[model samples]
Target: MKKFKVSLLQLDVKFGDPEANYSNVEKYIEEAVQDKPDVLVLPEMWNTGYDLERLETIADKDGQRTKTLLTRLAKHFAVNIVGGSVATKEDGKFYNTSYIFDRKGQLISQYQKVHLFGLMSEDDFISAGSTLNQFIIDGIKAAGVICYDIRFPEWERKLMSTGQQILFVSAQWPTKRIEQWKMLLCARAIENQSFVVAVNRVGNAPKDSFNGHSLVIDPLGKILEEGATDVEGIFTCEFDLDDLKAVRGNIPVFDDRRTDLYF
Candidate 1:
């Protein structure tokens, strides 16, 4: 199989301000499209940055606006999009949500954050997602998860069992624990034997600071591309499906797992 080029938009979202953040991210997306990547990714909370107090007022109503904007961009550029997580209002509650669009502008999959961050009081403001996020892009099985979701290995294992080769993570990780973020991401890629693409926001929030270490890791746990801590930029990397296949075949770790005895 031929390799696919991917771009990660590491943006600096203005705290508690949706309009400014949205406009800034729109410009980043416009610039990213110039690279003509197969898939373009954004960081978490691209719509509203940690404005949980005002979610009831600011959350996207049923994620309609986000879908419309991302779908239009996907169609216009003829590229797949893994839009970062947004504060989405459905029914009477709100959730941290992600939307995926195909090249033809079709909404393929939508995932709400399953693991809410209690330290930030996310559970108080948002409803947790009930289902796993799995989709196929360009005939390749892929999965996506939110910021804190990476802490759970079982979730990624579940997706791997379903034949996912590309794992996309959108995060708003804090600068205080950047080492954990990097270690966890590399571990996930190494253990799952799949390509791991993570996009994290930069700049400071109201109560916390975020260091943008957005990166793309190969199946062998090699860092292909990474972004700087202080700047807003787009990083691109090419991933070869054949290389992933060879790595998995040579190791056979998944095939040798003793799942039947684990329970």
Candidate 2:
């Protein structure tokens, strides 16, 4: 079906505490599934909130715990899951990673955050990812990226070029720059002529306090649903992929791209 429902779990993550976060995440997922959304998304760094220094110790080893938890939940609910960015360790190196699981609990895709936020000291502890995140979920072409990746349009363009109808962004954006977060999301949706579902965490970390303005935007840059600032709740919205044809046909942005003249 072209029509699909998406839900964002705008949760408050506890810093450096994977066990508590795990319990909280499970509770949130149970709450979110009540909406019966086809796809459920979580915020960036949900497992460990910018606990950069302790990443070597706190990061999920091989993402085994996260994978198992999300997989079981996905299968139980019969829902697709975008297990938002988590701090993971592989081969003794840490990375901000995201996992996607299909309804049957099959792992469809995994992406390490390509653009590490140097300002947050992410580069010092977490390794950067080099690959793009593109996949299909619930019969719809979609892509997922972490927090800081939203600032880079070219990277998003590359993913959308594949004709993905939905772009899922998992972020832990701070209150200081929340406006930019909203603007950039809408801009990406308008530019790509694709749906944008962004989930940001709320509450405070050691240094930064996040404002959850989780949003669901249409191809036309219209807000389908938006969460209250700093509220921890599930925000659900429904839209049809069939609408993309009319939107893209009218603008023809992708078709008219002059790739040869641009970088």
Candidate 3:
């Protein structure tokens, strides 16, 4: 039950410009690695912030560029990375994809946003991803989900039931719904008895203003570390597996779940 340190890259993403966003990510990664964190996380759509109309044009082609940089940095820093979601184009279709890299710089998992936000018109532009992926990070079972995906408790529970210890969420959630983001993520952790490490972007977009409340919540629903609403900075925190065991042992939510009644 060793403790793991995490560094969250909470930065504003420029709308409709992949080049600027990529450059910003590179600069932030440089700063983040300096801390020598055990793991690094980024916000959703860091490459192109909800530039839905231009996704077909501005999206990363095959995600090669993003993969290259994330791989290089992960290898260089020898840190595990839960790369935030990026707008990636493949086979003439666009998807909001999240990539994961291990300390060895190997691509571990890729999850597209399974639940698209119709309110933001994401359904109109992006193809929904179908697979739920699980991987190991620093010997911890982990998985990544996009912004709106957290709303579906069943989806999160499904993954958690499959031995997922850490749930990494990358979001461009609107300021108006920051409360929902906070409540839902805490609920996800409390109900599932797992650590929830979520990162949200700060600053404004044409549709909504994002106030980064990037959070690191323990299985007991305690906010161990939280980012300010408008600040763009790297926030780091540490979590130990002992926390998970203590909480789960006390609550026994997983053991007490009514499996027969769960239809």
Weakest ten-residue segment in model 2 by summed lDDT:
131-140
Q: Provide TM-scores for the models.
A: 0.97, 0.98, 0.97
Q: For candidate 3, report its TM-score.
A: 0.97
Candidate 3 lDDT (Cα, 0 to 1): 0.90
- lDDT for 214 (candidate 2): 97
Compare the candidates by lDDT and give the number of the best one: 2
Q: Tell me the number of clashing residue pairs for each predicted model.
A: 0, 0, 0
The candidates, ranked best first by TM-score, are 2, 1, 3
CA RMSD for every model? 1.0, 1.0, 1.1
Which pairs clash in model 2?
Answer: none
Tens-digit lDDT string for candidate 2 (153-248): 999999999789999999999999999999999999999999999999999999999999999999999999999988998989998889999999
What tens digits encode model 1's per-residue C-alpha lDDT throughout 201-225?
9998778999899989988888999
Runs in model 2 lying further than 4 Å from the true structure = none
lDDT ranking from best to worst?
A: 2, 1, 3
Model 1's alpha-carbon lDDT is 0.90
lDDT of 3 by residue, 79-172 (tens): 8989999999999999999999999999999988899999999999999999996889877898778889999999988888866788999999
